[model samples]
Target: MLGASTWNADRAQEIVDEHLSLEAPMLPILHALQEEFGYVAPEAAPLLAQALNLSRAEVHGVISFYHDFRHEPAGRHVLKLCRGEACQSMGSEELAEDLFTKLGLDWNRTTRDGELTVEPVYCLGLCASSPAALIDGEPIARLDATTLGEAVDEARGL
Candidate 1:
């Protein structure tokens, strides 16, 4: 997770202008916003709507529909666990619960200290080694509690 976005009208306008020329600018604009900010701000919807001549609801829908789009800021380190069928069969569901308990946080929630955030991802294409997870964007296959906890600890600088 990059840091929380510093939401500013000027920055938003600049981003909007940069992508306004694309044939389908919504995705590009949103992606650019996310790239600059950790997630898109709520205010961005209205700005995007005005630029595209669409309703704010339509802009909101597009952002919400994309699983990758984060409405809120993520923690310093993001842990995306696979929830695909292969991983589920390999006990990822159980692992997810275990992590939730260990981290004392549910999916899409950040830790109190904002050191780590746990989120669900459908697949990482690591079926051969199921129960995969991406720790700070680094893919890990055959995930287990011990490894994940260790990584989390490391990520949090514990």
Candidate 2:
């Protein structure tokens, strides 16, 4: 039961039940939980474990192994920067670091004011337009640090 968060156990149980009939239902169940709750509530691991008759460790492993299943609620805006090789070659790493430095954000952390959350994604399929970002789900490519900062600022409405 996710007592402290916006999520509740009843909803978690509903989501688990809805996906239980599928083969290897864990993935779908996790996805549904994230979609409904903004993140997979930590309380959900036990609920899911009980429903699937799995150990909590197994459920937790899947959540940790997958980058998309955010453990905490994201801020009002999300910045998913590409960290794949192609993007790195185009200076995505440096640009991302600059933004992190400027914003005082670490990987998967929200800002102190809860305005933005930045996470790394292995790929956004924008390799051809390397050095890419998805800011609030809008694609911005061919990024220099200044350009990236500008895009982030724009996306954040700053």
| lDDT digits (tens) for residues 1-158 of candidate 2 | 11124788897898899887899899999888887888888999899889889999988998999878878788878888999999999888788788888988888888988888888899999999999988887898988988888886887788
Off by over 4 Å in 2: 1-5
RMSD, model 2, all Cα superposed? Answer: 3.4
| Residue 66 of model 2, lDDT score | 86
TM-score of 2: 0.87
- The clash number for model 1 is 0
- Tens digits of per-residue lDDT, candidate 1, 1-158, equal 76556778899899999887789899989988988888898999999999999999999999999988888788989999999999999999999999898779998999898888899999888998998999888888877888878877877788
Q: Which residue pairs in candidate 2 have backbone atoms (N, alpha carbon, C) closer than 3 angstroms, thus clashing?
A: none
lDDT of candidate 2 at residue 56, scale 0 to 100 = 98
Relative to the true structure, candidate 1 has a C-alpha RMSD (angstroms) of 1.4
TM-score of each: 0.92, 0.87
Worst 10 residues of 2 by lDDT: 1-10
